[model samples]
Target chain A: MSLRPLLIPALLLASLIALFGALLLGSTPMEASRVLAALAGMADATDVTVVWQVRLPRALAAFAVGLALGGSGAALQGLLRNPLAEPGVLGVSASASLGATFALYYGFFSVSAWLVPVAAVAGALLATMLIAAAAMRTSSVVTLILIGVGLSSFAGAAMSLLMNLAPNPFSLSDMINWMLGSVANRGFPDIVFAAPFIAAGLTILYAGRRGLTALTLGDEAAAGIGLDLRRQRLLVVAGAGLATGGAVALAGAIGFVGIVAPHIVRPLVDHDPARSLIPSALLAGLILVLADIGVRLLPTEFELKLGVVAALIGAPAFVWIAMQRRTISAEQG
Target chain B: MTDSEQKFELTVEKLCIRAGGSLLVENASLDLRSGELAVLLGPNGAGKTSLLRGILGLAPTATGSVRLQGRAFGEFNPQQRARRLSYLPQRRPLAWPSPVRDVVSLGRYAWGCAPGRLGAEDLGAVNAALAACDLLAMAERSTDTLSGGELARVHCARAFATEAPLLFADEPVASLDPRHRFRIMQLIRDHVSTGAGALVVLHDVSLAARFADRLIWMKEGRITADGPPTQTLTESRMAEIYQVQADINGNHVEITNPLP
Candidate 1:
């Protein structure tokens, strides 16, 4: 049999096995047969609750959110034509955090959980508009990147100031949760809240994939291929905003999947930016799910936040990719 | 290459250019007919690049109007204009290693060809473009991994894939070797041989004279001459335009000015 046909299915199988194992094994270990019984709808009440209400939703959230981040990151990097570009680089996540913080600070969540997501979407859109306005005119990608960084820092600092001024425990909790980005305690409603934006973003990106590939050869060539620079940039901005914002609204600040997933998957796809999307989504979901599973596995009396492990993995990877690109740029271009 | 068939016509009137407080090209007007292989010849900083940019609506294009195929340039929608006219800027800087096949397919963006996705026509166009540029062997190779000559061909493939009626390229041969220069010019000529018009800004007058059906010679913000190569590319016109002495021994012109 050709190994090609087995690649995705094999990866999926390995992931499913790992996920199943992680779900069933822990401080309260469930037997494989019992887990299968639960899966097959023959389990008793307690096993059904444990498997369905808690483990399954958490795992699905981890996978779906990871998919959003990974796909968004891949698309963002290609659209920006810089491997270093990420959702955080453009301040989308920070803006979402600020929005969620604002909602909780004002007791919007006390009225409704839906309000928090609305706030996040609004904030993300505003921040995206600001970044696009500031950086759209210049021919310099470095300048655009720097503007994004500056805007992200501004949003982060503002978020910190809001956190410090917080008068209630809800604001503090919301800020912390938003920053750390967890998929815990999520239900189907949370999934519903995020699905539309992520889908829209991914669609916009997928639509522009060919253009992103063309851009890798440079702007003039991309234009020669009939891509209008302004229109393409607009699409990229809207796509990244919708995706990163939706993911952030759902899971908080879940860091690095967008950056790490694309970089890790690019080589496998032969350095073609468009091909990075599918593999990136898979890798991203796999990483987040695994990380989420690890958080449950940790022996700490209090749960270790998912973001801490992700940061540990992502920070080093970011540094390595940055250093690698800088060293290779002189010889490559 | 029929004489009767024509699609896009670029007309510029009283085009003046001043970049960074220096007048580069002044009061240049041109009526570029459709389906013609037009080449701009100029010395360094004689504003060949500016003129091309002016035509593409890239430059500020002070005190002038550029009509694309009879319509005012600004009146057309940006995407609609892009579909009709395409531009390749000078010394393209592609920093990443995108595949050659993927790079050429960018031409479908104005048409909104989505990712992991292409229709039969798109694939056919991509394959045909690669073949036209002789990049079929390196279709899957990383574009950034190629030599300069190869990179130029990949860009040509991209331009060819655009399927626009008018193509504008600035200094398409600046970094190319001699053999590659000939090849690039030939490919560009082939592309223009279709109903599509092509305008290339070049520093090499001999190459322009050899390849282009119509020559545009510019100096100090003006079109000093526009005609056939045999009439306008004489020794005196070369000396006057370049501010130096030159000799045209045959079809080739050599500059014999004192070394600066």
Candidate 2:
């Protein structure tokens, strides 16, 4: 496959290695040989159960959510042509989190375990549809970002109100924990719910790859090149939102992977903004898997939030990017 | 038929375009054909760009119809219309360090080639476009690092890559050096002569007269003078449309006075 098509699989494999490393080498201390042996189908029954049943699915959840968040950010930023744009930053994640909260409050999901992420995806679709409707009016990048921010502020406020009205203190914690975001206890059910949405989002983003490529020349130029700006914008918004919403539902509010991963991987693709998506998705998986491991490896016994870890990692990364951008622009000037 | 034997025409009739609560281009009509390089010349905000946008169907045509190849352009999907017509706006910003080749490949978007791959025709059109604009050497360089003139040429290369039968370029040569400007003018003129139709907007009346086969003098939201460039660049029409006297001698029209 000449490493082009294989790039994703390779990155996935590397991420799998890292995920295994995280599982095998946690603070609990499992032997490396035992870990590899279990993974390689040679471990005893107890080791196999520990490696396969307990930790494997959680690792899978991180990978899936990370890929969605990263890919969603790339697709959104590409559609808006704004580096500052991110799925969580733009409010899709919050909207879906709110959706999950609402779904929980009604006791609707108490009757069914699968309803949580599904409700979150619904919330995500609503937010995405709204953003698309508003952004389609103007082709300006600034206007699109501004509209995203506006929608995000509204969704955030509504989500806060929903938090206030939670049926009980425990429900509030559930809501809070959901917003704080985590991939720790996620199982195959979460993956099944989120995967199809992310897959759909990827398909749309892939389909609009040509338009995104054209848009780098500016909207008029893209139009000149026969790209349907409105249609492409709508598709991207929906795709980015759906995938991102699914992640939010599965992981709560894992932050900055969507933004930082794309920025980090841009250099790998020679800065072709359109081709940055695949690498962004892969790198998101890498960063998240490593971050999840760090959460497990923390000195304290109490589990720290994964979102906190990401913010800690991503905040510095964001600052570095801003500094780099300023230095580059100053040099250019 | 050879490009020389073919004749493509663009017809804009009863066209009206409004923006920001004003008629930027109203009741405008014009014709452009092969063997004719038309220049839409006027002062800034004289509706030159608006008229161009209307013909390209980018602007909201409140009233009017544009015909490309005698087909109702209004009925053509925007992308379908874009396949036959190319446009160069006054300014375009590269938000990323998009490679010059990748930028130009946008012109082949109407071809709808698959991602991570290009077909033979798409590759040919891209290559021909790069060759046409003389941008082959720097095709691998990032456009964001290009100088203003180089970026202009890169955009020109992109527009040409569309391989459209009609071209609407708005101040395309504005930031170019004299050498590049002259070369670009010659390139536009040659392409027009080779069967494709073009309307190039210009502020330099003399260049319009010297290079364009026809003149479209847009003034205050309308075509004030439209005819052969030599016939239209006269003192009265220039004074009427531009509100300044023009010194017209044979094919030359000077907007600036000589040293006393």
Candidate 3:
């Protein structure tokens, strides 16, 4: 039996429920009716402020970031022909985070709220273009992945050096907090700023979906099937860069969402790379929103970092998937 | 243009392929036409695969021109090229566990239907291919669950699903059992018999002799011989090229290498 007919609707519904549940969580639990009233634009001013300004924006930001990560992850996986490939695997997230950190260090955040995301998007495009150039020269998946690892390590070192050379403790703490990843204190403007980049990335990925599916047969066969492989690679790389850069700009370098989200959707979609994209985005959005709520509800003095909770949940899930793949390949072989 | 040329014809002239400063195929030329099963046979490192890749435009040509029908090979758009030919590489490990039918439908990729949403025409082609490859029963099975032979048949079905006038297959029966090897060879022969062009590479000379209408034998990046199988697969030629002793009786060939 095929579950695909039900999977998309089920995921969309689940995401909606999660978003609603997320809106109701905080220091004081609000009634669903009041939440619904806020959504319908008929709530009192205090309720409207709490629901609209605070919870709604954070929820939307989390969802948008997840959407970008998920779409970026699925596209990267298709382009590299490796299930383990993700936006972070190609160093886009790390580079974007470094760009954001540079913005904070130079006080660009104070100048214009959009400058940090702009820098992050620039950084991501730079790293992805480098990777795409390397990919053109070599057809080996291992070589491409190794190039990504090198780029990621270099970006990490650069970020560490920036933090080491901070002129003041205040800027250092701010950089540190951003690195931890969060959806807190994010206003509606942040979501608006990141949405276009994410939308462009997702559109690019969607356009390449068929070619990506054809590529599962490998490069020569894919080309025979009329897929312009070079063009396909560029679309995936550029798309992943824009999406991941925007995501990191809104919520720091949230690790593992890209890697974990696709795995969750692959089985439900019969493991078709093309079919997995939208579903993976929805699932990732749901996962991030729920994680954001959990961090808020934690009993700690300060809310836990969103990235911390995600990595905590997602890292183990990634390990489990790797182990499962090993066993499956072992049995098949 | 003549009706024959209008149908399909791929002409390679003085094609040379170089990789990493080493010449893989040197000044090899061949004309592939509809209604023919041409075999490329050679010993290891003899540039057979390189020649095949060169013809498919997967390898860069140092000094050569390839023309499809009356146009330069490079001039055709991707969809136009794909509509003309389909290729089955030697190593095709279905990366995803997509169902057999879905995998086959990917061959119709040039049609530009929405991904995973096959039209009736696409489904008809896919079913015909699955039936041709005797994989109809296994169409619903996940590719990862298939045996090596089964997976090979699935790849053939995928190539067949394209319904292109020309097909190129490199070592289609490299590591299969005899039953599967014969089945795949027969399928290729059948495809060409319907007035389609086929260029196949095979390590098994006996299979090549049985299935190919014409043979192009290569040695050290050059065509050592090209003719009917009887003329090309001569006992003396096999000894010179393969470094093996062989016996030929009528249509049968037996390789009896007298170890030095």
Candidate 4:
């Protein structure tokens, strides 16, 4: 029997538990009773401040970022009809990071905090538009993936050039921190700024979920089934752009969660792309939350960056997933 | 109107399809009525598939006027067109390992039902399609595990599930064994007998002769013959279109040898 019916609810529960764990296992660890009391607004001001002002926003930010990445990854995988497609692999996240880097290089945060995310969104939209235009020109999946690699290389070079020309050590360090990707010191304002874009992006992906399912039969068959291919491409591209941009703005640039999350949930849903979306998002959120907790718990002079921790865990998972796919395809052949 | 009295017709006029700077199908015209199964037969690269795609408006550079049931094809939106006409292209690679039932249920997409959320009517259509294609036993099997012939049947079942008035299939039985090949053709024949129309592309002349109510022979982007199978599947016509010496005995054709 298929486990799809229970997958989403289970992921939701796991995400809540992980979020609670995030709250309970911070630098200043608190008892479960104390944390619950703080959540209920029954604790003293200092405890409430620690829970509400500090851990809550950080946890929520991590979840939102993961939600964006995971949802975008599922939408893109469906659109491209490739299991490996994701914001990071498609160069969208890198482009968004370059935009954020530019914002940091120019001291845009001092001028207005919102400008950073705005610039990141603009960068993501630009990259996604380029990819979408190329997709229209070619029906070749390999060509699209190669073009994404080229785009990513160019963006990485641009970011490196920006960092190399930093005006001061402080600016260079700031750029490095942004590139490393952390949810540390994130506050309610950051979540407030990024939430709408993330919400809108996920909403768009959700609306186009059925089209993604139709795409599993390949492009010609999908169009034969009466799906408007152009419209579906637009929805996926635009949704992934907004979501990835929002994610980068929220937590620098986290990799692999997007790819790994959907891969984990796909089998549960019998590999149905439409059904994998929400479950992927929830699982990714849980992963990032757990990663954040790991980051805090590690014994180190400096707290581990969430992106670093994610890459540490996720890159291996990515390779394993790729190897598994190769084995399956070879077996089928 | 009762099902038997309902009218279904597809008309194509002066259809031209160009691809990569070369004309693939030129000035093709045809009409199909309910209770008719038309098989398109030609040699390799004879533009049979291109003509079918052109009529379906899937060819990127197709220039044609097509009408269904007396209304212009362009007047309908994509979903509405899908509701009226269902197409089965050459067997395409399945990207995901979704269950067979789920894949077939995608045929109901034009009617606004996604897989796993099918309404009673949509479920009925899906089940009927599976049963029609002899796929009910394997409905829960993952597509990735199916053999090529089974996968081809799954696709045909998907097309059948649409329940559209007109069906355009390109090489629907190309990979099937003889038994399955005949079964698929017979299924199309049965579908057409229910007051619908089907235009199937086939390389097997004998199969086409056995099942098609009408035969359309295309050679190099043009229709060379269009008539009843008995009149169109002649020895001389087969030699002209396929460059083969052939023996035609009633509805069976034996390709004797290829011309030098």
Clashes of each: 5, 0, 0, 0
Of 1 and 2, the candidate ranking higher by lDDT: 2
lDDT tens per residue, model 4, B180-199? 89988888998887777899
True contacts kept of each: 0.61, 0.76, 0.70, 0.73
Candidate 2 residue-wise lDDT, B1-260, digit = tens: 13336567778898988877888887999888766788889888898888877787778545797886788888888778877788888768676787788778877777775324578877888888788878899988887678877888788778877778788899988867877788788888877766777899987777778888888888889888788865777887877777776678977776553222
What is the CA-based DockQ of model 2?
A: 0.66
- DockQ value of candidate 4: 0.80
Compare the candidates by lDDT and give the number of the best one.
4
Residue-level lDDT for A134 in candidate 3: 76
Candidate that would win on DockQ: 4
* lDDT by residue (tens digit), candidate 3, B90-141: 7775678889888888888987753368898888888888998899998888
Per-residue lDDT for A13-125 in model 1, tens only? 76687678756865588999998899777999888878877777778778777877888788778776778777766677778778877776767888987777777777777
For model 2 the TM-score comes to: 0.90
Candidate number with the higher DockQ (1 or 4): 4
Q: Look at candidate 1 and tell me the lDDT of residue B4.
A: 24
Q: Rank the candidates by lDDT, best first.
A: 4, 3, 2, 1
Worst 10 residues of 3 chain B by lDDT: B1-10
After superposition, which runs of candidate 3 have C-alpha atoms over 4 Å from their true positions? A110-112, A130-153, A167-173, A331-333, B1-6, B258-260
> How would the docking of model 2 be graded?
medium
Clashing pairs in 2: none
Pairs that collide in candidate 4 are none
Worst 10 residues of 4 chain B by lDDT: B1-10
